[model samples]
Target chain A: MDLVNQILNSFILFKAAFLILNLILIVFLLVVLQQVFAMSSVITDAFDSGIIRTVAIALLVISVSLFLTALVIL
Target chain B: MPDLFIAPLNKQEEPKQSDDLLMSKSSLPLTELPSNLHLFSSFVANPRGIHFQNQDSDEKVLLFIKRDLITNIVWVGISILFIFIPIIIAVASPFMGNFLNFLPGRHIFFYLLLYYLFVGTYVFVNFFTWYFNIALVTNKRIIDVDFSSLVYKNVAATKLSLVQDVSYDQVGIVRSIFDYGDILVQTAGTLDNFHFEAAPSPENAVHIIQDLIGKEARNGLS
Candidate 1:
């Protein structure tokens, strides 16, 4: 019973660490994506601005939402 | 002593195209941009509407093209499969209930949703790469912009006067029906060959380049 309890505690700790790491990674990706979008907009002014902006904003929102979902589920 | 022989050889080697004839005949006018071709969604047929990076004050964009939309069918099919596979698995879950005991119910669904979102993001990024990478033709140069991968991009340009030969090949039934083909531009000396692959109306593109080259020749002669 004591061994099972110790294993359960270890699993919980691992799960929490995994969630935090995943959240950090998602945040990093969000920053990288935003920078990429900005650079693209600057380089290709002839591209459809509306579409680029829309997609960028959508990605940002979805990523934040995913982060929050992770917080809740984890 | 060899002057008489040189004159005849020079005359035979020279093309018979006169500057006056070339100038008198207007080049083919740029046509309306075609549709149902995702690759050429924003192909600038005329010099009036578009601009490019590092464009000179006087240089004009004659044509901008991307690969044929048909080329994307395979990846698009795969994306469709990714979207449907989860639903298919869910539908079959009843039969494999025992098999999936390891996946707790609501949490498994959430995890699957997260996975789909990541895939969706990946697909979005690739779509931008496909849509933005293009081949451009300007009055003075032929330019190829390749978004080869997520982290790498390459742009190559050569002057129209340097282009030695231009040819096109339209193979396969679909390409023939749609009049889309690959335009290959061979440059003089050691420059890399420029390939405008799966370009729509390649014959017209070739004519445009030929007219530009003829104009350049005329300018040089005068």
Candidate 2:
């Protein structure tokens, strides 16, 4: 029973750590997104730049979505 | 009658296109050649619709280069390996026994999802690093745009007038096989040298720059 309790406690601790780490990552991704915008403005292409920005935005969205889902489920 | 009347108008226009027109015509050899580049190209000659800050309105972008596409194979392979981790673990689960129980239960799905998302982001960052790290050869100048680690970027450019020598190095078999190598541009005086690493068809690029230099010298523009 004690072993099971310890395992459960460790698991919760790990989960909390993961959530905090993910929050940091979310913030980092925002910076990456901003850099993409900054770079696009510095040098640009006619047709393909929109796709690059959109992909960066998509990566941010997916990361945020995963963080929120993890927060609720865990 | 219309042809005869229009012929004199054409004759009157001939003097307008004298030495300046001939110089322009001489420079048109490469410019008149069609150079169309797709979205993901590594070596783009005469790419249309590429513009940079501080660029002249009439400046022409001659080449846009990134590291060869083959360079991304390492990250792509690792991402593929990561993507299959769950399947690999599932196959090994019976042999491992109770070890699988160590995973955060009920939240395993969320963990897996998060892990995959991290892999996705890794792929994205790698792609972005490759995609944005580019060297451009324009009629007016050479520009190197460096984007690395998603947090740092540097853009450097030197006018065609400053370019003194352009050369390339293809050392190893891999570069030779891939036909991509580093291009070094020796600039005049104390200006920084420009290096384009793993540029495609480097000889072609050197030739283009040489042509531009020759033109600049001929026109006394440099």
User: For all the models shown, what interface RMSD does each have?
Assistant: 3.8, 1.6
lDDT of 1 by residue, B134-190 (tens): 787877888887764555767789998888888899999999987789999999999
Q: Over the stretch B31-137, how does candidate 2's per-residue lDDT look in tens digits?
A: 44336765568986667788888898777777788898888889999999999998899789889895778775666777776777788778877887888898987
Model 2 in CAPRI terms: which quality?
medium
lDDT score at residue A63, model 1, on the 0-100 scale: 62
Chain A accuracy as TM-score for every candidate: 0.60, 0.86
- How far does residue B170 in candidate 2 sit from its true spot (Å)? 0.9
Quote the lDDT for B51 in model 1: 56
- Regions of model 1 farther than 4 Å from truth: A1-50, B1-28, B32-42, B47-49, B101-106
Q: Runs in model 2 with CA error above 4 Å?
A: A1-8, B1-34, B102-105
What's the TM for model 1?
Answer: 0.75
Q: What are the per-residue Cα lDDT tens digits for candidate 1 across A1-74?
A: 99888867765664575466456547645754664564464335444645655776776676677657756765
Query: What's the true lDDT of residue B111 in model 1?
Result: 62
RMSD list, candidates in order: 6.7, 7.4
